[model samples]
Target: EKMPLTPNGKLDRKALPAPEGALQTGTEYAAPCTVTEAKLVQLWQEVLGLERVGIHDNFFEIGGHSLRAMTLVSRVNKEMSVSLPLRNVFFYPTVEEMAQAISELERLEYAVIPQAEARDYYPVSS
Candidate 1:
């Protein structure tokens, strides 16, 4: 595809069309359903500087870089109260995948917690 260029020979970013198969702006969008997805969508919007972000939108395709990804991971840890490895962001670039990874991390954390052991109780005479 040919990129639109300005009179000065610079790429006209504004005139460039959205990539094929990408969600177009101003179209009806489906909001996130679960809390995790909602949080991710909000974070993506803030981090990526876009007005609307769908669950299936690709993070990198929307101008996300390594620094932004790191920032996103940090925010996710702070907001979601979970420790997620940085690599997970690359592995799960989309909100849906990231949310699923967060859910799995939460499940693993819950599973790792040690249960309290039962203790015998003795009555004391006054």
Candidate 2:
């Protein structure tokens, strides 16, 4: 049975308190194996300075803001070649969801995108 209850008879997640101390490093999540999970965890650490971050932890719950969220997406693109839009993070905040998105993105970009259209173009310097 659920341990907590909200005002409206829902899960009182906000009312629930955090652990007494900082989260422990190497905490495990039921996340799948994928580059996206690794990358997302790394970004979380760089932003939060945590030795390790679990997959199920919420970014904002851990003190992330919109500015930091944007930074995260930008870093994901630059580092993982995955152009994760800002909204995507909100929708898929968990590592498992993000990994699914990353796999789908890889399939679309690599398997379906036409080579000609995907080629990087540079305008002539005048």
Candidate 3:
């Protein structure tokens, strides 16, 4: 079993065949419930070249690996504006869990500084 290679001695990814139909994994198929989850499912399907991906399906179990995980993270960062760690993919291997992690990373957690505290700042340029 060998991957198709281009004339340049590189892997011919386009020549790779896609998985047939929906991928079967250990967990039962569950459609994404939230927008984030739906986005993750779409990304996974695109990255893995599958027809359907469930929110509960494990990324690795469904034909994902480190390389595909990187591609997924790159797509998520580009499309969702959320930075995801590669290791986190292993930690949150399911679409639902990865979506939750992405949501947490995208969440804005900030504390408003007191108005009076602003007065203590000295203008360095002025």
Among the numbered candidates, top TM-score falls to 3
How would you encode candidate 2's per-residue C-alpha lDDT over 1-126 as one tens digit per residue? 456997688888876776687654344554435666887788777976766567777776666788888888777776777667799889887666776777777522322344555548856796
Cα lDDT computed for each candidate against the true fold: 0.83, 0.71, 0.84
TM per prediction: 0.63, 0.58, 0.66
List, residue by residue over 1-126, the lDDT tens digit for candidate 3: 899999999999999998676555768888899999988888888999988898888889988999998998778877887768889999999988898889888633333456654565766783
Q: Which stretches of candidate 2 lie over 4 Å from their true place?
A: 1-20, 23-32, 107-126
**Model 2, position 28: C-alpha lDDT score:** 53
Q: Is candidate 1 or candidate 3 better by TM-score?
A: 3
Q: Per-residue lDDT of 2-114 in model 1, one digit per residue for the tens? A: 88999999999999776676556443466888999999999999998988898877788777999999999888887788888889989998888899999988522212458
Regions more than 4 Å wrong, model 1? 1-29, 107-126
CA shift at 73, candidate 1, in angstroms?
Answer: 0.5
Candidate order by TM-score, highest to lowest? 3, 1, 2
Give me the displacement of residue 42 in model 3, in angstroms.
0.7
Error of 2 at 85 (Å): 0.8
